[model samples]
Target: MSSSTATTAPPATTPTTITSPSPSSSSQQPKPKTKLKLKIRRAVAPADVAATTALINAAFRADDTTDVYLGAEHERISLATEESVLGSMTATDIAVFVGVVSKAAAVDYEGEELEHKEEEEEEIVGHFWLQKKSDTLAWLALLAVSVKGQGQGWGSQLVAHAEQVARDEWKAQRLEFDVVNTRSTLRRWYEKRGFVPTGRAKPFAYELHPDWEGVLRADLEFLYYGKDL
Candidate 1:
């Protein structure tokens, strides 16, 4: 789910909900109500760097669909190093948001168990970055959620938050992003979220710097997409 050139995703179906019977019904039937507890806020100081890096790597590694694309490009599961994560935090144009889930809603990532005390604390399960591209446009990059965090509607919530920040805080009229051209499933996922292909594309070569960890390959290219805020 990271357009940061690390991971891919399959198309996700919309969540289904069943309505409860009227509260006043005479039949002795009732349904319990519960609310999801998700906290979305700016990632904390330097401490967040390690957690974010680990989450992104875990998410991409557990997703086979993601590997199909990244592996072909000879890319590593991790797109960000601790240094890069911390570096982005200080940039004025980039904002990183981390989604912290309540313990009640937490699930073991990829079936990996945590000690009882560890499971009691809230977990940072998802993250994304918003870059102010220009006065009227913003771009979202490296959006990812841990393996167990997906399908819980948290991804959509993060996207919505990005759109709101672009419009309300940045005064931007549009939000843009790019995806590996080969990941049709991911493209369709964004399509459902109101993004449309813009007919613009760019090479996804990981040669942005000599120290970058992602491998450079000829098959990688990014296809651009955008949404009106």
Candidate 2:
């Protein structure tokens, strides 16, 4: 009797595969409403820089990250940040003019991080920056999505926004980005977004990142990527 009971309990204890609710029934469930509307604001003002930087920095860890961290502080802590990537003026003229006229060369800031100097309509949740690489070429300097807001297509929308600006506003013939060879989630993400490798390299960035925890071991191969603007 005891042996029979043990075998019966074993059979009853086996896990069952439950079927999921039907699509029509699942669709009837209440959907939670959200206040934040997902859209890319056309012009990012100077005031948006600080908030955006914090958002971008959140994508990194303390030890190792990527090329975007080069020539910058080790941590994302803004309290220790020496220079403002985002500017304090709505206009780059006053700030940029100072770079040109003062102790430092303005060209030195050509590839520097972004700074905002003026008020803006919407808070910048994510951003994509583009600069003229050539008369016909525009480089995507940065594309960062707020950590909490990622996986929601904000990054894609931002990329599309940048391409439109490059194509229509800048009238650029080509758009590109330098994925400083690192095995990163971002590297794959960019490829999924329609960018292809250009097989290029630059050796100077590693010296600036001697402490890189991520495998930025060499100045390494920068896989340049492009898509028609």
In angstroms, give how far residue 70 of model 2 lies from its true place: 15
Worst ten-residue run, lDDT, model 2? 12-21
TM-score per prediction, in order, is: 0.72, 0.56
Q: Which candidate's lDDT is highest?
A: 1
- The TM-score of predicted model 1 comes to 0.72
TM-score, prediction 2? 0.56
lDDT of 1 by residue, 1-229 (tens): 2223232221111000000101111222222133244689998666787998787666554534332334433554445567666655656667889888755446433334435555466678778878787899987877886555455667788889989999999999999877767556667778888999999977654555444344333465677899999
Q: What RMSD does each model have against the real structure?
A: 11.5, 22.9
CA deviation > 4 Å runs, candidate 2: 1-37, 42-46, 62-84, 87-122, 209-221
Instruction: For residues 61-176, write the lDDT of model 2, one tens digit per residue.
Output: 22133343443344432210112333312322211100001112111223343354354234445554455556788766445554434334556666777777778877888887
| Cα deviation of 65, candidate 1, in Å | 2.9
Number of the top-ranking candidate, with TM-score as the measure? 1
